[model samples]
Target: MSQKKVDAYKAEKANREKIMKKEKRVLRLEKLIALAFCIVAVVWIGFSVYSKVNEGKEEVVVNTEMDTSALDDYLSGIATDAADAE
Candidate 1:
C-alpha cells in the first residue's frame, strides 16, 4: 500500500480509539449516577417505613398529663420516712 494511504488509515484508527475511550467514560458516569439514585431511593423508603411505625404511637412530652403536685406529694412521704430513720 502507498505510504499516504497507510498514514491515513493510522490517523483514522487513532480517532476511533479516542471516541471509544470517551464513550467508556460516559458509560461509567451514567452507572455511577444510577447507583447514587438507588441509594437515595432506599434511604427514602427506610425513612418512610420508620415514620409509619411511629404513627399514632409517638408521644409529645408537652402533651403529657403529669401533675407536679401529685408527684411531690408522693415523694414527700418517702423523704419524711427516710429522714425519721436517720
Candidate 2:
C-alpha cells in the first residue's frame, strides 16, 4: 500500500475508536442518571408508605358518650315537665 493511503487508514481507525469511547462514556453517564432516579423513587415511595402507616396508627378517639349524655338530659327534662303539667 502507498504510505499516504496507510496513514489515512490509520487516522480513520483512530477517529472511529475515539467516537466509540465517547459513546461509551455517554452511555455510562445515562446509566448513572437512571440509577439515581430509581433511588429517588424508592426513597419517595418508602417515605410515603411510612407516613401513611403512622397516620393509620394514630387513631383519633371520637367521644360519642358526650353526645348520648346530652340527648338523654334533654329527653329527661321534657318528660319531667310533662309529668308536672299532668
In angstroms, give how far residue 42 of model 1 lies from its true place: 0.4
Candidate 1 lDDT, tens digit per residue, 1-86? 99999999999897998889999999999999999999999999999999999986957577557669978988998999999999
Whole-model lDDT for model 1 versus the true structure?
Answer: 0.93
Worst 10 residues of 1 by lDDT: 58-67
lDDT for each residue of candidate 2 in 4-86, tens digit (9 for 90 to 100): 99999999897998889999999999999999999999999999999988986867888763458888999999999999999
Using all chains and alpha carbons, the TM-scores for the candidates as numbered come to: 0.53, 0.52
Off by over 4 Å in 2: 1-12, 59-86
Task: Quote the lDDT for 48 in model 1.
Answer: 99
Model 1, residue pairs in steric clash: none
lDDT of 2 at 31: 100
